[model samples]
Target: MTESAFINITELTREFKNKTALEQITLSIQEGELFGLVGPDGAGKTTLLRILAGLLQITAGQVVAAGYDLNKEPEEIKPHIGYMAQEFSLYEKLSVVENLMFFADLYNVDVKEQEDRIQKLLSFAGLTEFKNRRAAHLSGGMQKKLALATTLLHEPPLLLLDEPTTGVDPISRREFWNILTDLHLNGTTIIVSTPYMDEADRCSRVGLMYQGELVICDSPVNIRNLLDGDLVKITTSDWQEAHTVLAPLAGVKEIQTYGEALHILVDSGKTRLPQLTRALKEHNLAVDEARTASPRMEEAFISLIRKMDQVN
Candidate 1:
């Protein structure tokens, strides 16, 4: 482990009776970094987060979080990390402030400071107005904010959030991330698992998990650069026929359909642009737009997964 690594894992593996959830995974995260974990479902994102939160036992390997060895001192590590689950456990009958008070007592927040801390968190989470409302009456977004607020009452330095914004509305998701940004700026180390590529783009660094393995780990810029070819956006009158015509062409790596448009991954956009245009014309297909486009996180992720699938 590096001197500055706040979390480190080596040859980590987890298994159920019939399957391996994580396999030989190794990673290191520094203090105050916002690290995003992204992957398809059943890719072990939740298992990893659960392990970090001291909720699950590691079947193998070393994990050190917040200066405590998870294997040797799981209980000791619990107090220093704030963990939020995908389906957060909230007391349905409890009011917003009541829920916060419940968790404050559970986390053993200082008696004298609890009131001040709860008040601050209620405002920070935009729930001050709804403090007296029952948890069952809150909006989905409001409930998520309440869950996050409860997690923050103790103000742990590290947070393990499992898909915190998964089912939230776009506006609420944005608001939640803004709160996370403020916390990050205040020097908290956050590890969040999200399925949204745009959310992954906002992280300081991202780890792409696939079939229980960490396939790629890097800054968003670097991960996007991993796309082996350029992207050419082509819009056609009949995208169905255009797709068939472009499938067999040389230099074309992959063809992704987007309603009426097709994003073609080619060896070189300059070389394939005219070739694609000419071929479509020969097939009597009308082209409305054709241009080289930048590769985005979605395309890069799909391309990388395709390659991995092919190899496997």
Candidate 2:
């Protein structure tokens, strides 16, 4: 491992049969850094996390994590990291506190200190009141919190979470992030893969994966600036027709639709706003709303993936 890198990967790759899952994934995450992995479906996010957690084999390359070579000492690295899978199992028969005690015992927590630790974790995960509630009886959000609390039983220095917030409600997701923020503040390095762009924006840095490759990795602001053009958001009753007209017009380079609003990338928002409006009017389309808008993470992510598709 590098002197300061908590998790160091060099030219890592994973293969299943003939399909390449991860290709030359080289990354070094420093201590206390909150790294977010973002990409479309089947982008190798889970593959990379599984390799780091010692749950999957790397077909090629090197990984040094927690001061151990993953290839040679997979078991040695396990105690240094807390890995939570998307479908991490919780005994549906056990209550929240029972589940915590089970993992604490498994981790070999000191008999005398286990009670104190479990209590604190229950409070931390906001499950103190639900201590007696069975895992299966808990809501999707609460169950996720319980799973997270279980992973922290050993108080590992690093956390590898794979879509911990999927299927969770918005409020619960926010609360989950709050717990993560607390962990990050206390100097625990976290590498989380999420599809939500807003979640990616919360990380100190983000790595975008695509087609079994780490396509881009940088700060959220830097990634958004990757698209060197302005964005214009427009809403029209005739969005289908408007799309057909605006897609081929001058200055428009890319377009995406979100519900009834259309987001268009152009050479310059100031120059294209009037040009686009005029073109829409010429086609007799009613522009419900149109304005120059700030570029967002989703736009940047899609723009990067689109460029990658073109290259391939």
Candidate 3:
């Protein structure tokens, strides 16, 4: 293996009792890169992270993560990876420091190193003042941070996090990402799965998963440029009705909704802008506003998934 390729997956597939979670997934994550996995729910994001963390059994294919062959030596791989699940899996009854000590024990961290490590991690996660407080009494965001601190107790080179900031307040979510950014700057290879498009934009690279396969993986800038057409955004109370009216228009290629607004992909933005306005007027649907807008990651991702669905 080369020095940069910290995790290499080739034709990896995982199957359960009656379902296949991942199929033919081949990816290479370089050392110290922040990789984001973004997709709709049930897209096998969890399965891929579990496989890398030595938590799930792979039915076929090869995976070399953290300099250990996962198929042959899953236990050896554990020491080199720190995995944080989506839920708050730390002990609720224990104080913040206790949870860290427990995981430090599980990972067999050096006794002499435990106190210093725990003290730094508490301050690092902003849980220092709450160190004596029970984990169950911490806020949602604090609990998530505590879980992250426990994972870091092992001082693993690779971090595999699954939706770490989901369901948290926006401010707390921002705080968690700041911690991740610090880790990345310190040369820690982090692979995180998140449903938030904004979070995906912050990564060094991103992978989009669909239906058990990795559909696309690239830098966020390149992914935004992958949109084949320009976007014409329109706001209306009844976007569903507007979508039905304009979906079959000559210039409209794809229509996706952002809450009440619709992002319509078109062959030519200026030519289709007027056509869209006229069509809406003809249908007696009052559009709040219509203009050519730049495509974002959310639009590109939805477009790719739509294309994949069409191909299948």
| Number of the top-ranking candidate, with TM-score as the measure | 2
Model 3 steric clash pairs: none
Q: Write the per-residue lDDT of candidate 2 for residues 120-154, one digit (tens) a residue.
A: 99999999999999999999999999999989989
Alpha carbon lDDT at 49, candidate 2: 95
Tens-digit lDDT track of model 1 for 225-289: 99888999999999999999999999998998888999999999999999999999999999999
Q: Choose the strongest candidate by lDDT.
A: 1
lDDT of 3 by residue, 92-145 (tens): 899998989989999999999999999999999999999999999999999999
RMSD score of candidate 1 (Å) = 1.4
* Cα TM-score of candidate 2: 0.97
Where is the poorest 10-residue window by lDDT in model 2? Answer: 1-10
- The reply for model 3, stretches above 4 Å from the true place, is 1-4
Q: What are the TM-scores, per candidate, against the unseen true structure?
A: 0.96, 0.97, 0.96
